[model samples]
Target: MSVEPLIELKGICKNFGEKMILNDIELNIYPGEALVIIGPSGAGKSTLLRIIAGLLAPDTGEIYIKGQNRQGLIEDKQDPIGISMVFQQSALFDSLTVAENVGFCLYQHSKLPERKIRQLVEEKLEMVGLPGISHQYPAELSGGMRKRVSFARAIMSNPDDSRYNPEVILYDEPTAGLDPIASTVIEDLVRRLQQAAQVCGTYVMVSHQESTIRRTADRVVFLYEGQIQWEGKVQDIDITDNLLVRQFFSASIDGPIRVIN
Candidate 1:
């Protein structure tokens, strides 16, 4: 049986002054799937993500969460219905230690005890392959470590509390600015998270990294010029004859895509 979409977007549109960022976009993200949105720097990939995260309001369109109309609801204010974001910049608090940062959401939103929160934090860190650094501050951690910490933070939740567990985790360039090995670690962690029964949820990631797209995506959506230019299963990307897909994967300069210099 086909699973119902966890999140759905319809007639989505956005404008920044005179320039359009997204245009009548439609998408369905299914449960237990990793959907990756990809495009170049100016392709509005991030804008699409922010709109889905409810960080920015769209000029027009509707968002459905679990088949419920949510266009009128505001994020954070409405409690986002089990949605979380792992930012491209890591977005960690320098003043807070790893443990504190990881548990920040739980402390703010839930009535969980401190000791239990700390235990959950440690488990999340360990899951992301970064154990025993909970006491260290974010500033002390390397770039890769900090990214992993953000991943841990995104996945941390009370085992007994379903409200604290995100049903959709949106990753904005989770592997950006990391070395190959570090990138691989993040990729593996993403795959693991999607399959893990304890934390499995529908995930949507926006990234430009070729390796990241190849390694982490179960489905791929290629957004360009304010629309979804192409989409298919991850394996279809390599063999698909779509010019944009071919040029993007091959990194060829001779295609129809023109680079601004």
Candidate 2:
């Protein structure tokens, strides 16, 4: 039997004032698959992720999480359900220690005791290869450390039968603004998380680094002009005879994707 799609988006349309950001976007994320989306700036990649996270409402179209409609969940009011995101900036609270930041969601949502939460938080930190840094504040950690903390927080939770293991984890520029070594570290952590979770959670990320995209993405969706212009695997990328794909992959300035004056 075929497994059901973990997330489905149909005919999604979004606009800011008169500018249309996304138009007729139809996509599906299956269980245990990592799908990476690569696109230039202002191509609606982040907006699409926000819509899936229920942080932004599309003017038209439908979003489904595990077959349940996500129309009513606003950005803040949406139940945690089984989704999470690691922002580009590693948005950790400066005042809170690493443990507190990782366990913040559990503190807010679950009635579990503080002791239990701390235990889980420590485990998550160790899983991400930062075992004893829980007492340190975000200000005390390095850029790569902060990203790992954010990643730990995103996946810190019980994977029980009743609660859905994250059906999707949307990563917004996971490797942006980092040194080459740091960027590789973040990419490797993503792979580790996928394997450790053992759940069929899909990953959809927006990134500019060619190395990260090649390492993590099973399939690539190239967005341009607010639409997907090319979709293919990493190997096919080299042989794709599409002009737009070639131009973007080669980082050539001459292409259908033009720089606005």
Candidate 3:
């Protein structure tokens, strides 16, 4: 891992009405390491992921992208590096074809010619194991296929500029709602992309699926009620005696985690 962090969160805090979603949170994402954030539903895992991606701002804190303090939201300030995010719902545009959806950013922002953009789109789709379907619409695909398309979109970058390529990605439940086999395929794809030259090796994911977390993460962080309760390597999950971790993995009703109705 690199000595300098690619992304950093310091004293992060967020609130919704009277409820606190994240409290004094701090995290660092290093290069070449895949980290997974896991916790019960409503544990603010996704919220934290969004904040890190700069899609949502924290109520109080600072976000540093590649050691430089971020000036504004992702759109406002062009950071030194790119940080991409894949939403849980596979948020593809219904009106656009797969190629258009994957290449939306480039189509709208880049000066690259249409032919070159199409070629890049095909390459990204192929990288995600969904080649030759660029002409199809998102509605024509299955849930898993749509998710993969979204993955391709998230990794899409302008070949003319390295700033468009993300050094870190945030995945919000990429494998959710898929069958076991489909989930495994997505999990494997995530790991494979980690090694791909076009994609960044470092990523942060928020997932509830045990297999996805275990298979994808080099390190794991457990969040509960707006705070980190436990964090360790993937191997530590099985041996950690932390009450929260044990209760979460075992799905037991009795523990420090409060059950909400």
Candidate 4:
């Protein structure tokens, strides 16, 4: 691991009306590692992922990327390094074609020609195993296909500026609704994308699926009751005696975690 973290969160807290989501959260994302967060629904994993992506601001906390403290949301100021996120919903625009959606950033910001942008968009789509559907609309694709399109968009790059290449990726329930085989494909894609990242093969994922957590995670953190109750390496999760880990993995009705109706 590097001497410094690529991303760091200190005392992160968030709330929605009367309920508090994340509480006093702290984490560090090191280079060349796949970190996964696992917990039941309403555990605040997705919220923390957005905060790290700079898409959402915490009620109280600090976020640092590449050692520079982030001020306000991503629209307020750009981070020192590139950070991208694949949202849980696949969040694609109904009107735009897959190519348009994937190259949205470059189209809006870069000086690249339209032809070049299309080529780059196709390249990214192929990287995610979604080739030759750039002209199709999001509504025309299947759920897994749309998610792959979103993945393509998240990994899109600005050829004019190498600094814009993504260093860290935040994934929110990437395999949520997919079939087992499809979910496995998505997991493989995540690992492949990490190897293709510009600066480091680093990614942070939020998942509840046992296969995903075990296959993709180099390290795992267990979140519950608005905090990380346990953390360890991927294999450690099986052997660790942490009550949270034990209960979560076992799918037990009895433990510190009580299921919500």
Candidate 5:
């Protein structure tokens, strides 16, 4: 039996003034699937994620989440879905301690007591393999630790208990500046989060590291020249002979994907 897509984008088109970013893009994210988007810079990878998160509205296209048509302005001012994003830079507040940072969303969105919020924050931090570091500030932590904290914060739930599980998690260049070891840790965390959530909630991430993609992605979508040029499972990547894919995987400068002068 075919599973219903958790998220679907049909003929999605977006542009900034005259420059087109996403062109007739169509994608479907099945529940519990991890879809990694790979592309050269400016190929609209992050833009697509933002669009899916409803942070940006496409010029033309349709976005459906959990079989509901999500087009036009959102009726609810809050985020349409239980979606969270982990930015590459681990955008944590310097003033807030790690626990406070993780619980910030809960405090703002729900009426939960401070003690309960702290407990949930600790749980999320432990889930990310960083327990008892919640008392420290972001500046006091290492880069990898900061990223893990951000991951924990992104998954933190509100006290009102609306929905503890996120419908989707968007990761933007998750391992960009981290070392190899740190990158691997982040990759493992992504997989663990998917398993723990146990929901059909989709995971869509943009990354440059082949190892990270292979480790975390169930499917890969390659974007080039402002569109998705190739897509397949991670295992098929080596066998597929698409020029763009070959060039990308090889990290070769000589390929169809050219840098503008």
Candidate 6:
């Protein structure tokens, strides 16, 4: 792991009108690591992901990318380095074919020719294990296929050759709404993508799924009540005695975490 942080969140605080979503979040995302943020629903996990992706600006905080201040700068627009986001919903254009969706960024941003773009798209599709379906539209594909297509689109560029390939990929609920089998497939793909040499990058994911948290995280952060309650390594989760952590992992409602009716 690199000593220098790939992404940093310093004093991140977000408020939606009157409700506080995130409170004084301080974090360091290292290079080539899978950092998973786990939290209950409406805990602002996705909001935090958006902030890191530079989609949403925090009310008060400093976002540093490779040690450069990125305040008020939307990362997607005029970002110095590559950062990609896989949204909770597979936000694909239904009209566009799988190939078009995967290659959209390349065609719009790069000077690469159509043939080269197509080739890159095919390569990415194959990387996600969904080759030969490029000609098909998103409507015809399963939910899992659409999600993988979104991933391919996010990582289609080459990180070493060009600055366009994402150095960091933010996943917002990657395995949401999928059956156990399909969820396992998505989890396997995420693990494979991070380990693959061709497109390995730092990944930060927000999920409520316990299996996803265990399978994909190199480190885990538990966000609740708009703050980080506890955080530790993936293995430590099983041994920790923290009330919130134990209750969360075991799905025990008779502990410190109470549901108000």
Candidate that scores best on lDDT? 3
Model 1 off-target regions past 4 Å?
Answer: 76-80, 159-161
Q: Give the lDDT of residue 153 in candidate 6.
A: 95
Winning candidate number (TM-score): 3
What lDDT is obtained when candidate 2 is compared to the true structure?
Answer: 0.84
Task: Tell me the lDDT of model 6 at 204.
Answer: 96
Question: Which is better, 5 or 6, measured by lDDT?
Answer: 6
lDDT of 5 by residue, 200-247 (tens): 246899998888999999999998767889999999899998998898
Which residue segments of model 2 deviate by more than 4 Å?
Answer: 74-81, 159-165, 197-200
Error of 4 at 256 (Å): 0.7
Residue 51 CA error for candidate 5 (Å)?
A: 0.5
Which is the winner by lDDT between candidate 4 and candidate 6? 4
lDDT digits (tens) for residues 1-261 of candidate 1 = 888888889999999999999999999989788899987778999899988887888899998888777755454455446788899999999999999999988888888888998998998998888899999998899888998899888887666667667888999999889999989988988888888877856799999899999998989999988999899999999899989889987888878677767
C-alpha lDDT values of all predictions? 0.87, 0.84, 0.92, 0.89, 0.85, 0.88
TM-score, predicted candidate 2 vs. hidden true structure: 0.94
- Candidate 3 per-residue C-alpha lDDT over 1-261 given as tens digits, one digit per residue, 9 for 90 to 100: 539888889999999999999999989889998999999999999999988887888999998888899866888888898888899999999999999999999998899999999999999999999999999998899999999999999899898988898788889999989999999999999999999976889999999999999999999999998998888999999999999999988999999888988
Candidate 1 shows a clash count of 0
- In the order shown, the candidates' Cα RMSDs to the true structure are 1.6, 2.0, 1.1, 1.5, 1.9, 1.8
- Writing each residue's lDDT as its tens digit, candidate 2 over 11-50 gives 9998999998999998888878888888878999999988
| lDDT value for model 6 | 0.88
TM-score of 4: 0.96
lDDT of 3: 0.92
Q: On a 0 to 100 scale, what is the lDDT of residue 251 in model 1?
A: 84
TM-score per candidate, chains pooled: 0.95, 0.94, 0.98, 0.96, 0.94, 0.95
- Writing each residue's lDDT as its tens digit, candidate 4 over 97-171 gives 899999999988899999999999989998999889999999999889998999999888897996667878888
Comparing candidate 1 with candidate 3, which one achieves the higher TM-score?
3
Candidate 2 residue 225 C-alpha distance from true site, Å: 1.3
Please list the residue runs of candidate 4 whose C-alpha ends up more than 4 Å from where it truly belongs after superposition.
197-200
